[model samples]
Target: MKPSIITTLIIILFGLFTVQVNHRHLSRLRLIEVSLNKTAAGLGISRNSPTSMPKASYSSRSRQRHADPEVDIRQLANNLIEMVKMIPESESPKDRGELMNSLATLSEFSPSQIKSLLSEIHKSDGIDDELRKSVMGIVLILASDQNPRAGLDLVISSHDPNGSLMWEDAIINNALRSFANSDPAGALKWIEDNREVHPEVGQKENLEIALLGIAREQPGTAIQWLKNIDPSDRDDLAAKIAKNALSNEQRMAILEEINSSFVTSLDTTEMGKLKESVMAGLGASLDPDDFEGSTAWLENSDFSPEEISTITSGLALKNPCANTGEWISWMVSHLPDEALPNQVTKSFSTWTNNDYKTAGEWLESATDNAAKVPAISAYVSQIVFVKPQTAEKWALQLPEGPIRNSALKRIASVMESIYPGSEDAFKQRHGL
Candidate 1:
């Protein structure tokens, strides 16, 4: 049953050839890894850590000559695509810097080259969703670099109207930002044109990205565009535009337009939101050091008592515990009876944390029991665990009300957990 000598020799040689082929294949893979690492280094990307590549503009590319023939765009793109295919599906490969560097390399390719690559990638069954989105993002950016309309069309066609994908918003926002930066009027026109066709494009946050970019360069045009949109959208968008204004003058200009434009009386809810937005914009614009100048702007406005209170709430939300003494004086003078308690509770809590002695002094000196009750409650809440006796003394000072009751109950709850029989005695002593 022994095989012929010639047959055995042939089998041995075949086995040796198989091992050599595998060695060559592994060597090719290692070479690719080394080449890519070198490419990443040249581009200032780290192969081991993820980094965002800046948007590639035509002017930026034009400055550099395409002198390296060995670094052919097509070849680099092919190698990166193959590397992307090797990444495990369950792993987040984008967390690796290689994919981002791959994108940087592919970004230099021509629109036609990008289109060809996209076609090939579309036909590729091995590419995962992460790689697919990364490639699409690069395509969208490059397409927008030349023509916003073309870029938007590619985005709309690739994405589903009803379903969301990872990086979908970022991809769209980046494209719109590039478009708006280059041509604000053109970007606005595109939105107006496509709002009906793609309702998703009309989302408020989406519009803000473009509007912010537009407002940066063209405030007048941005305002004119804002005036024509839905009443509901105008207030928030106007606020955002004002918030992002380049200078104080630009901020005031947008705010004045908002003040002048909504001449017709809006419903209660609309007016409230408008007031809040206006105050929020103003709050965002306030210079922390220029307290006098900042407060002067709001003081000069023709805001009603109710409107002032609402706007003050917005200001507190933006800048809480801002110069606690002066802040309390301003709030007491302006904030309505209904808005006072909640504002005091929140702001004083923050103030007590920063400087309890100063906070306690102010609370004791306050003439208004309305302010004192909530202020005491906030103060006690902060020190309840660390200084329970001080908390009890402060809590007992409050006049009979919901604020006083809540502070007592909080103290009792803490005591119950810390001292076994203390809850009942504390509750009975405080009249529950």
Candidate 2:
């Protein structure tokens, strides 16, 4: 099977020809890409020359631009131009998204470079509207950060024959929101200072975004910011920061700020709705592990009666255990008719589900106690689901009284539901 020398020489020549052809194709692409810089400038596009990047193209045609270490700005500057020239709508959005994502990942390109690249693509002739939309959509994702100068520059300078806007309100809002998250203090100050400069900026959105960001890192500062916003402008924004109150300390801080405001009217239903909304948000923000800490803080705080009622009830519903015996005692004496409906019963019910031994012991000892009926009634409702027999045992132990009768009434009903016709027998056993 030995080949002749002539045959081997022929194979070598063919291999060399293939390499030369491939190299020529790539060189042609580079030339076309680089020449766009000249054509773009003549058409009034300002080409940004960021720090010179080493001359390179993605070594692999399909490799991710970010993950591929060899990718450089000089290579990407023209690559972006060529990518947009691909026949409009010829590629799926997913494919277009990858290209757009790669462009955004080019952090090596200054904001100016990104803006220039986008402008060239938009102004480039022969691209279909569908393809232009795809490019515009991708550019929006890239422009999601705070680069107002570069973005505004492109918009103002664009000679887009189609009258398209790449720097619309959504884009600016995104930039402002992003800037606020990154630099809340500076961003808010900028908004206040630059009102005349960027009058169209959504000041409300910007302040709300900045306040929410500040709430996480500087809650006390956020409270002051909340106070400073025009009262007419303080709609649902407070609820946003209020929801960040994961700790009792943060929630109480928010309440203190609210109390200092002029809306401390307990006599009006409108005021109640506003206060209730804020307290409800704070309650939902509470961490399950903060149950003990919340109770300890509630003891010393000077919350008004209505505020305390709504706020504590909010906490009790999320985690019934937060309504410890002292809380139930306060509710019974001060809010007898409203105590159970306010969901104090839910606290005892939840505690029993978690630690029945402790809850059962607590209930057994509280029999015949004045403030015990609510707790006992709450317990009977919870136990009837899994352990109707256990509920019957607890009910039988109750001495003759309203609470005992309430317990018997609940237990007998649950037992009959569990075992048909057992209610009378259960009542007889408990001497009902």
What C-alpha lDDT values do all the predictions have?
0.60, 0.54
Question: Which residue pairs overlap in candidate 2's backbone?
Answer: 320-347
What is the Cα-based TM-score of model 2? 0.54
Candidate 2, 82-183: lDDT as tens digits:
554541433343433444335435433455666656666666666655445445533543443325444433433442545544224444455555566567
Predicted model with the maximum TM-score: 1
In model 1, which runs have C-alpha deviations exceeding 4 angstroms? 1-103, 123-166, 178-186, 216-224, 227-235, 242-256, 264-269, 319-322, 353-358, 364-370, 400-403
**Residue 82 deviation, candidate 2, in Å?**
6.5
Q: Summarize candidate 1's per-residue lDDT along 1-432 as a digit string, tens digits.
A: 332222221222222222222242223223223333443455444443332222222223445343254444455556656655544331332332354344434434555555555655555566655555555544454444444556676667666454443345555665676667777667777777777877777777667767777888766557657766777788888777766666556756765665566546566677567757865665665653465765676677666667656545545555444466676667777778888888777778877877787787787787765677778888999978777888989888877878688889999998888898899999999888
Give candidate 1's root-mean-square deviation (CA, Å): 12.6
Indicate which candidate wins on lDDT: 1
Clashes in candidate 2: how many?
1
